[model samples]
Target: MSRVTLAQWQMLAAVVEHGGFSRAAEAVHKSPSTLNHAVHKLEEQLGVAVLEPVGRQVRLTEAGELLLRRARQLLENADALEDVASRLAEGLEAEIVLAIDQIFPPDALARSLDAFSEAFPHVRVQLHETVLHGGVEMLEDGQVDLLVSGLSARGFLGEPLVTVRFIAVAHPEHALHRLDRELDLRDLEQHRQLVVRDSAQRQSLDSGWLKAEQRWTVSHLDTSIGMLERNLGFAWVPETRIRPALEAGRLKPLPLTAGGVREIPLQIIHRDQDRAGPATRAMAEQLRTSVAACAGTRNFENIE
Candidate 1:
């Protein structure tokens, strides 16, 4: 009861989602022993069992189910109050600075800013373009109130509005492009693969992605697309970015999801307890909806 905080609940939920001590540990980057101890400590305090072990797997108990819902509500309310308190202490007049990941498109932002400006034009909105791989770094620096960015490596939240599929891509004539099924990351070992060095690429491509004899790491997704169009090398990219190309028959996606290939996630982030004022709140709402519009999912699922 006394030690039951938002953190324990987070670990509890992670344990539930992942279904085992080891997997949940990996998901939250905590050790199994640590997670086990914390969960037991929480259960002891609450005087209700939280997990039921079933042949090396763990599922939530009845008490765990009840506590999960209550824990989530508490975490959310605590975050909201923190946001509110910070804004009041700051006089609600502090400018809101936001960092946009370089990979973030201007079109997505145009609509969001339109809604924000229409509602609160006087709240100074300072925008900065973050370089690739810097989304979380910028947030950690406190340089941005919110980050409208692509998938980050780790530590940042994995709030996905859109599931931007990652698939093997190539020009019309490349040997790999003719496949009907999407190519996975491992398939690149045999072909000339071009990989981008941006946030999207970093999120999708890793050591497990490929072991190709010839690989190129370009600075931009478009550049990789350009090389693909030239029949130079195959690469992985967001399907959304190449939807036009696929529609035009200029490129094709190899069918697959094996290897380390995965959809690039988009996230909106502010400090844990940092509250938004009228202007910031208005802008945050618009930003959230705008991301959902781009992503085609109304993900008001996790809004911390």
Candidate 2:
């Protein structure tokens, strides 16, 4: 078995990152000869040439590239172990990554984050705003510490947060508004519909009623709203997002014969509720409070 040490892998990575041995030695506070010796010993132990000379510079061989990739993961896991140890000894975590659905009211999210920042000033926060199926995917992939989503993943329980209302809307002067009658699916199919594409990489989901022959798929709800305002197409947009537009006559609700409005129930999800840390639990509480405030419901216990 090869007796390779973490120090040797770190040295190799530093050399690759900083360009040369001398530079890496300076960066890592080691002598050039020590770094050179470590690399040579590592290659001898592994029985493979890791680095090759390229004129004045050095480059990793194919074997070196593969080993370095694995080394990076090991180093990251080692760092995480230390971080978790420190957090367990203390009461605060180093950082918390949160993923939230796009349809969730932005004002509620902002308020919750603002409160969390004040409460945990020492802890760093990373926020990801995702579209349909995106937040669930992030949670399942273990990329985020917490998730707020409209759809729940199978085998995991989610706490109900709030319900968001969506309404079919278009520019005031659009042909649909000019019709001045309750329109059916056939009428909408003849016009252009603005659709937001699902952000899931493995399984894409189509939401709401979509039967338009001419459709424009966008990556975000804001883009769909913008397109609707410009008379590019009609879309089902969050009521909270288009309130100003509706009052200003920039956009108006479509008089659909059916399926004019949709209410989506959003929930807070954690990978393991039993293992949730203090910061994560606190953030979840803040999210629930913010949603309750937005809904004007004093009885938050009634949620779900």
Candidate 3:
């Protein structure tokens, strides 16, 4: 049972922020006397002189500085609570489930998420990092509100997001580079290849495996990249994912006569676009905006 009220603290803050009751009253559409009485009552309830006369304009006392500083935080939280309540009344979604492919640009994904959280601070996000058809599976099962994938869903239409380039690369010290000649599919088949396993539980794909003599399959692209960096094997990895490694000379691209690179266009699909709430729609918009913004900073080759 507290004696002070949020409205009273709000009045005190208005007075302090405006430097006097007269200005704060005008700013808040309240009379100066009403603002004065609220501040006086607040100080009396707290048993402290929160404001002191400094000849003309009043200033916060030592106790007032600390008390009002804490009260500002409470005020901000109360406003945020009210905002959430209003959004809920307007049918804002409480949570958004998003399934994105592993090949998507990480920078664009991070930027979109940061922007989404800033706009909808209360909405919860469940991010599923899928590979190949995994995102499409989630959309098919109605497990996610939004899906970003290189594969299209059977019944749903998607908007073109971006084109990702995959390059065949191996560590600079790998044995394939020692041959000093342009390698072909036959040369690569003799050595080991690292592949990322499809993440889907059912209807999984083995799209990129080259049927090498020795092959290693892992569940995540990060593991494949790690294996490539350690000179374990070669794989066709996303250019965005391996850009740093390429720039650092830790990995070298294979000098194949042809078919050394592949382009996969990604898409944004909603589980049910007509039924999507505000948060879901906003998340989709942010993803598109992020991809457009990130595209200008990088350059990719058009190797056939």
Count clashing residue pairs in model 2. Answer: 0
**Tens digits of per-residue lDDT for model 1 on 49-119?**
98999989999898889889888898888786786667557667447787776445444577889888766
TM-score of candidate 3 against the unseen true structure: 0.94
Instruction: lDDT for model 1, please.
Output: 0.68
Provide the lowest-lDDT 10-residue window in model 2: 295-304
Ranking according to TM-score, highest score first: 3, 2, 1
TM per candidate comes to 0.53, 0.68, 0.94
Superposed Cα deviation of residue 211, candidate 1 (Å): 2.8
**TM-score of candidate 2 relative to the true fold:** 0.68
Report the error of model 3 at residue 188, Å: 1.7
Best by TM-score: 3
Better of 2 and 3 by lDDT: 3
Ranking by lDDT: 3, 2, 1
